[model samples]
Target: MATDDSVHPEARGLEVVIRTAPMPADANGNGDIFGGWILSHMDIAAGVLAAKRAQGRVATVAIDAMTFLKPVYIGDLLSIYGEVVGVGRTSIKVRLETWVERQRRRDGSLTARQSMRVTEGTFVMVAIDEEGRPRVVPEA
Candidate 1:
């Protein structure tokens, strides 16, 4: 995938955990993608990393911080990148960023795609067992 050179320095080298484009159904009446949709995607990406690190099931317990840097429009390819920033006995913290490669009409023609950072958040996930109770996170 093509990347923008202007992305945050800290966002560099993070693993791209999820990449998907939003459909019209994912947008609000104002034609912008819903915040919940983006948040859900972030959560899913965090869960994937957390599960891998935990070596088992994991559940999102909290979103410690989330900032919407820009609006997401339909047809923009959203890519979520994540990394395991912290780990505890039973919880893990994942830092995630969502970037969008956008296509827009310019001068009645499609402009060259440009990538931009849209949202970022830190997700807190807890390792879980088969019964859905918190469990110790295995050592990596």
Candidate 2:
């Protein structure tokens, strides 16, 4: 059975996730949104929080528990949200959740309310110094 929890939206404690529409350039020959595109968005969301916490530059060291629940099509609006799940000496784990919204029919009879949940990945980012070496994260 396919597990929906892989990209469960409620997993990440996000107040407001940003929404963006997928363009033709983002899709593959089959017209499905490329996984890389979604991952990049998640990284961007995570980076925003990571930079705020590190107070400097940060690099992605690892991604944990990533799974693609459904294929995304062009014109679909994507939403991604992230939360700082864990913090180490120099690393922070950000849990990200992604969702998609598609347009309904002209009659507004509920065309598609599908929640793909693209993936839930824990991004490990390390704080970096001016020289790019890992530095201790500041206390919250």
Candidate 3:
């Protein structure tokens, strides 16, 4: 999981693939949601894109430059987006971004922004053959 070291705004060319609300059980002692949960969502988003491009099975081989910008809380809506930035013979690099929309406070005032990017990372996915091993990726 990436550390909450820095943050940035959303950009274009990224595909939004996952969105869900955080539950109470998904949080830690600090009441902040876990980072792994967010990362898993991002992986799922990347996997969907990778599988489509690979035209078959694919597995994550590496993750590069993961950075978490903010902490998510319960009742917040989580959204993840990813895009295939690079493609190799058997691997693809997906740039992913995660965001959250927290519910407003009781006073009706804006408790949080509409969409806050929590984390971003580059996930490498390898195209796999029927035997479940790495295989050549088709030309795009």
Candidate 4:
């Protein structure tokens, strides 16, 4: 067997944690959804899942480089899914994938929702106690 480098090679599976729509308020000056908005939602999704796995409170410690495959726009139904790629003593690494079902208007009529990959990222969350100290993750 070969040693695994930085990121783990295996992923348990992905589950949809959040489904939301980007509003006009979330749009950036370019008229597209702001990357920060999407990132914030992804972090929330990660925290929800991490807290459940940790059986308590958790905090986001790190995020790997993010790559946006497509742009997100208003009226798009965004779906955020996460998978547990790795679990350490006090940390749970989650991989988040964002897909969007976009609504496009053509000739003054709304088109069918088309789903496409928008962006993805990896977040490192640590289980914490009431005092905000790192704690061990409970076995599932």
For each candidate, the alpha-carbon lDDT, in order, equals 0.88, 0.76, 0.80, 0.82
What order do you get sorting by TM-score, best first? 1, 4, 3, 2
The top-ranked prediction according to lDDT is 1
Please report, as a residue range, the 10-residue window in candidate 1 with the lowest summed lDDT: 1-10
Off by over 4 Å in 1: 1-5, 8-11, 105-109
Give one digit per residue, the lDDT tens place, for model 2 in 1-140: 12355455555356334679888899888788899988888888888878878888999888876778777777677888677878899998887777777664323355656555666677889999999999999999
> Cα lDDT of model 1 overall?
0.88
- Candidates in order, TM-scores: namely 0.90, 0.82, 0.85, 0.85
Once fitted onto the true fold, the runs of candidate 2 whose alpha carbons sit more than 4 angstroms away are: 1-12, 104-116
Instruction: Give candidate 2's root-mean-square deviation (CA, Å).
Output: 4.0
Candidates 2 and 4 compared: the better one by lDDT is: 4
Q: How do the residues 1-140 of candidate 4 rate in per-residue lDDT, one tens digit apiece?
A: 12222222223246889999988899987668999999999999999888888999999999975778788887888988887778999999888888887778522258876777688888999999999999999898
lDDT of 3: 0.80
Give the per-residue lDDT digits (tens) of candidate 3, residues 21-137: 888788898778898988888888889999999998999999977888888877777888777889998999988878877666433456646666778899999999989889999
Clashing pairs in 1: none
Q: Per model, how many backbone clashes are there?
A: 0, 0, 0, 0
Clashing pairs in 3: none
